[model samples]
Target: MSISGINNYNYQNYYAGARHNMAKTGGEIRGVLSSTSSASSNITLHMSDVGNSGNALTAMGFPDGTSASVFQADDYNPADPEYRVRYWDKEGNYTDTMVKVNDIDPQNASYLEMLAYTSYSDVEGLTKNAFGDFMNAARGVNGNISYDADNIKEKKDYMSMVKELMQLQYDSNNLPGYLSYKELYDYMNDKING
Candidate 1:
């Protein structure tokens, strides 16, 4: 369960570790079909048949294996009561944790949509403050990141504040004189725009 030594991957050893873990966990990879074409010298895969195959997705769709639940992504609205996120517990058991939009981290909002099976609307209600908090924590801005809480309520304004904070942090770091101001500015601009 501890993969500390495998932090950085070496292509040669990754598969060996993966196979060992797979065997130990009784993990089965379904719906993957591989076929090689002799003439074309290529391989093709057909995976359209795999529908909601993950453990959390399966549990949400058919909890009892017979009756399908009424869990519909299209039906989810951010203004609704709450949003539920599915994550694996320490024992490898899938657990659904309901969270409010305010508590959602803006940095991992899209990741939550994919990995946790949360909807876009679930994170649509996140405020500027939440994004600021995520940026601060991620960048280690601490008390250095400053913004007018009352005036800068819009998302765009908060993003500008983040760009400023990034610039401040970059300036604070005493890099070699060879690194030009334009280089850092361009890098920060690209990050902010992206």
Candidate 2:
């Protein structure tokens, strides 16, 4: 039972009564509801309830959901372990990532915290260096990436000097890049940092 057929709402008291009745039935009233007596009209405006999804927000008038936000304002915090930004750079030889360098405040860190960019290709070498540091834990006093004697390659003179210093090489040729690359990259990180 909707009192919607009458559009000529000529009085203040009657319009208020209709609005009040609509509220009681739990039906949303959108658009204009007004009184002919007042110069100002009653207008109902609403935002499409976008429940935290970027795509959904984008559909509701935000441009691809790239709105400026606090999460987008997080500075690079090398100390914060929970934050990570991933970008696709199939154009480059390396997977692109941007790591902010700081410890995030525990009280304020949210699901949508911190901002990062992966399109900074000019810094791939530098970015890789930073990621290498992260993977090797070479950023602090608590971390010390080292190779055991068995993992080190023996020099000809050193081998001759020490006949017992023989080592079995890690055979990773058959392994997938996921494993081999990680091990090799870790080793490289260790060597570089050490």
Candidate 3:
């Protein structure tokens, strides 16, 4: 199971559920916690090889007293209908709460303010043209036959876009005190290719 909130992808709870199932079946299960998530999201892996107990917690690769993840209250946003987490007070009156993401999100332990994102469809306005170019490329690049485009502008434009993206990565510097694109790219390649 996967849950996506804005940019956060919560996958740690998946192992908790998988642990219960493994306990029931008396066998281990392998699972990828998530396909995508924020760079620092905590990933969990659980196994019940020796059966459930305090040892099971350690066997599952979690530290002692590690609590299972819970359903989090959504972030607060006055305008977004889904953002505000409404709760009933002790007196039974409904009220909106202004909770920081860290209050609910395990990943945002520093209590950073809630973030908002604009989710675009697969073919956004900018990608619409690129989509057309891709279809053209696919149809033209069929097996065994070699055919050239009557108009190379689309191909050239795609190459320019790739170049622009590379330039932007280098020009943007990076997060303060964090790896620059060049360092991160080279480091990643070294680790992967080594």
Candidate 4:
């Protein structure tokens, strides 16, 4: 029941350091929604507030008529530390999206724009390494243990692919105004693997 690229030990260290940084910079509240409600509650709250003030769509930098929907999986755990969103546009229809709960300073306006610009899965689903895992499992290979080198390489490769795709998006004038291409790349890498 473990997921790669998410180390609780490393995350604890990161959180401690991030908290310290936030303290030094003055603790700023972070989160897309103004209400400090639960994620499930937020879903209902948002669904009811379309085109109104303080709705989730507007909070996410979308226009008045935009919408966001949640697909609550049976095993969904809002408390999971590794949780992140995967979103994409469905042509002229509403943006297909999921939700994540993490504190981010609302004052940092670029945060929403960054989220919007990178409106795709953080990890490209069904990667070669992932398929290999399935193949191994099918062959009765134990999934409990994995080589550190392969894990590290997979992480690097995934990040590299994401960076290249993001760069291409940016080159096409898709990046937000607040970040240069380099800044966006570094920021995403740090967020994913810091």
Assess every candidate by TM-score: 0.25, 0.16, 0.16, 0.23
The number of clashing residue pairs in model 4 is 1
Error of 1 at 159 (Å): 13
Determine which window of 10 residues in candidate 2 has minimal summed lDDT.
159-168
- Which of candidates 1 and 4 reaches a greater lDDT? 1
Task: Name the better of 1 and 2 by lDDT.
Answer: 1
Q: What tens digits encode model 4's per-residue C-alpha lDDT throughout 78-101? A: 454222222222232443333342
- Order candidates by lDDT, high to low: 1, 4, 3, 2
Q: In model 1, which residue pairs have backbone atoms overlapping below 3 Å?
A: none
Give the winner by TM-score: 1
After aligning candidate 3 to the native by TM-score, how far in Å is the CA of 19 from where it should be?
12
Off by over 4 Å in 4: 1-53, 57-98, 101-162, 165-179
Local lDDT at 164 for model 2:
15
Q: Once model 2 is optimally superposed onto the true structure by TM-score, how far is the C-alpha of residue 153 displaced, in angstroms? A: 33
10 residues in a row with least lDDT, candidate 1? 61-70
Error of 4 at 37 (Å): 35
Judge candidate 2 at residue 91 and give its lDDT. Answer: 29
Off by over 4 Å in 2: 1-73, 77-172, 175-194
